[model samples]
Target: MKKILLLLNICIFILGKEIHAQTNFPYYQDIQEFKKKDSLKFPPKNGILFIGSSTFTKWKDVQAYFPGYSIINRGFGGSTLLDEIRYVPDIVYPYHPRQVIIYCGDNDFAFSDTVTSADVLNRFKILFELIRKEYPAIPVDYISIKYSPSREKLWNKMKSANRLISNYLKTQIHAEYIDIDPVMLDANKKINKSLYLDDMLHMKPEGYRLWEKVIKPYLIKD
Candidate 1:
């Protein structure tokens, strides 16, 4: 009876540790799924790699947008720039992409009120520097945070962060800041409600169509 009780306690402790780990690292499972897919057949190198939050992840038909170019979409859940920095090895480094386009920072602002535009910009800079450290020649592009009805309150902070990143990119070689926000606005310079889904957070097909048009010119062709 004593031995069984001791074994049970050990099992409980191990299980508890696993639960804690999952909570702490929210996208572990999502990344593992990507690994599983890659193990079957890894994508070709020197392709365009898109890494960020659900905006990219939810783009299930991203390949359709750009017909000729090879695209590896590594966007996970509603992840922040910090999460991209953490998982760079698993998502960014392995592929050796010719170009990396990012769409993050919005989630960082959404998730925490205290997180300022500068804070998010700093996080982005950390990520950019990390990538440059590994692949100095690789071209990196940033898609400006979109204006959405659901997160209207945080638009100002998002715009500020976008401007900072855009200016910073201008100072670096092989880096492009793809500003898609202005195109997303209507004739009156307001966020077009029709572009977003019912959630008013994630975009609809119209929004993605706009992205396809803007992002096409920036893609590098071998």
Candidate 2:
């Protein structure tokens, strides 16, 4: 009986520390064929892959704004930076794009009981480590978490996490840090109503317009 209990504890410990694998969602194949009907090879010249949480997932007008560029949005809603870290091999690496714009972590802030702000930062560190190993030359860009007019309670925590990410980027030459937090916020430090949708979390068309403007200058061919 003691041996059985010990073996069970060992199994539980191993499972607890294990990182879960990501499967290619059925929607991914559909997303892979957007704007381009022709089959193509991996590592398309100047292809820009936009990845992350709902921010990337919810970009329906991405192509309309970012024309003359092969930009692909691979956003998975309700996911954190850690989930992206686990899935990049299938979602990002296969594409082999020159540039990747990662917009996420808004949901990661206390979205799951398992992940925290510090956990998000740690996941990003792990992600950067993986990127350095797998795709050293690729430029990784981080889109800042947006201000939520309604979730005032989480605002401080959000800002703190953003600062952490910005600070971490100080050392990475290929990583570009972007923050539209100022534009999204009003003088009161709350989300600007004009920029937000009815939900107060997602952006209205105007909010995305502002984001498009900020990101336009940073995009470049590799």
Candidate 3:
């Protein structure tokens, strides 16, 4: 029995390392450089962050929209939930941020036949558990998955995955679910025509405007 338990622990540890969490990616290094440049031009971090995948990374006008807030955009394009799980130490914890607003899993929903939307939620759930262990009292805010204009094919999966995360978040008292998806969508439940770029995957300036609206209210002064 003891021998079986030892083998189980070993397997768990091996699999833990096997998962493709974002490591020292060049993108993260580029972001580090951007932060240095932004510091030279703007102000230093005062404990606020918008952390996530491409959506957060692509938000170039963060400072313009968020005045008086020391916003750190720790966003890396093309990152999955697994990458988030791996890179939390680099992106999240080090800053000792007062609040973290996270937006991810859009790319996870992009793949058609691999993991189901429910499975993606499962990964996120595990991520939340791990994050809770790391930062017990800090509030974690989630931005609902946005509709990528050109990626209508990935929309259903995005909704499904977001629903699972949102529903779970509702049950937990520690987190806040920021509902930006609805306002971003048109009456037809499709992404607004003017909101996205030509690529169909990214938001244009107007889309970021709507994001700043709901997100601005939650900003706690440092």
Tens digit of per-residue lDDT, candidate 3, span 121-144:
776776676567767777778888
- Better candidate number, 1 or 3, judged by lDDT: 1
Which is the leading candidate under lDDT? Answer: 1
lDDT tens digits by residue: candidate 2, 63-162: 8988888886667665676566656665676677788788877777756654456656666766666666768887888887776776666766778778
Q: By descending lDDT, how would the candidates be arranged?
A: 1, 3, 2
The per-residue C-alpha lDDT of model 2 at residue 105 equals 78
- Pick the winner on TM-score between candidates 1 and 3: 1
Model 2 per-residue lDDT at 70: 81
Reference-based lDDT, each prediction: 0.87, 0.70, 0.73
Best by TM-score: 1
Off by over 4 Å in 2: 1-45, 113-115, 187-190
Candidate 3 has which clashing residue pairs, if any?
none
Query: What's the TM-score of every candidate structure?
Result: 0.89, 0.78, 0.80
TM-score of 1: 0.89
Question: For residues 105-181, could you state the per-residue lDDT of candidate 1 as single tens digits?
Answer: 89999999998887877778778887998899989999999878999999899889989999999999999999997
What does the lDDT read for residue 106 in candidate 3? 80
At residue 23, give the lDDT of candidate 2.
36
Summing lDDT over every window of 10 consecutive residues in candidate 3, give the lowest-scoring window: 13-22
